[model samples]
Target: MAAREYGQYCGVTQALELVGERWALLIVRDLLVGPRRYGELAEGLPRIPSNILAARLKELQAAGILRRAPRSRVVVYELTPYGRELEPVVLALGAWGFKAMGDPRDEQVVTPDSMTMALRTAFRPAVAAELPATSYAARLGAAELLVRVDGARLDVSRGDGPVDLSFAAGPGIRRLISGELAPDRAISTGVVEVLHGRGDLLARFATTFHLAA
Candidate 1:
């Protein structure tokens, strides 16, 4: 089916014409972190049908938002520079929507990319500035994320690296960052494990990322 358009002349409308389709922006969200193979994209967006996902990928590529390139003998999808420009827009949207979030619903799923994006959106620069430079490796289920804090900036990337802290991502970590679960309680419940860092560094990590209530 042809993509539906608003048939309007406004720039917002034009932009929406390119990305307003169902599953379009979510695909963009997955690509924002880095390039992904077709299978990886499918894993990230479990609900999107394969046919629909392929169509959306084609549409996005044709719109100059993303491109397919060969990587190590396999084709992977990555955002074009133009598509990367949407990073701030997506992060801002995530922050804005976060204010209205309540408890997670039973049917809701959280992908690693989405969780990483949340961390990106929740970084507190002032808090980071007060803390020493640190690196962390977080195992969120099967996904491993490397997070580095330098001065007032926080960067999160996929995969592990040498770091000051390592912890499993679970309710405890979530609660700790949200300021609901106490650090001691998180440790006691095995929700968080300090694998390679001082307690104080873990405390600093907790303070650096906070979800707005």
Candidate 2:
């Protein structure tokens, strides 16, 4: 007598039925960044109707995938420790989705906070074993991006100064960070414009990580 089942398949289908919805995975992505208020969640994913988001949250809570935090005046959602394990799985799925599908975009609106949060979950440090002594800049939107890949570490900054290569990137920054499009293809095709420095530096820098999802 489980609560969720599309039919009598009753195995993994039960779990899938519980979590499978158009936007369910995104809800988990939002929580992976940090706890968020109901309004905050709405902000992360603007395309989801408020009512639908509410129902999805409730369904996930019932499935033991999410839990509600005690709020004095505002409602907040936090991932249960159980729910946090989903981070890697979702990242891997996203990685595969990007490799299979390439650049992610929909009419669906996604917030900067949510996008940055999602990017961080699958962060690829620009280097494999040692971070570079020199930093790099990428320009996106009105923001000047600062990226430092020191060996195993990544430090991102914001400014329009010379450090290393400069990139004129767009939303596909997600795909680049996830390592879906080979950096070579991305630059050569102008999907990502490297304005300065050595493209080989980035290619060398990009070899460290694979999107495990």
Can you write out model 1's per-residue Cα lDDT over 1-213, one digit (the tens) per residue? 344977678989988888889999989998988899999999999889999999999999999999999999999999999999989988898878876777567776778888788788878989899888999888765567899999898888877688988877554456777778777777777878777776556677778888755
Q: Where does candidate 2 clash, by residue pair? A: 92-213, 93-213, 130-151, 131-150, 131-151, 146-157
- Model 2: number of clashes? 6
RMSD (Å) per prediction: 2.6, 4.9
- Cα deviation of 90 in candidate 1 (Å)? 0.8
Segments of candidate 1 deviating more than 4 angstroms: 1-3, 181-191
- How well is each residue in 186-209 modelled by candidate 2, as lDDT tens digits? 888777788789776666534543
Most TM-score-accurate candidate: 1
Instruction: List the global CA lDDT of all models.
Output: 0.84, 0.68
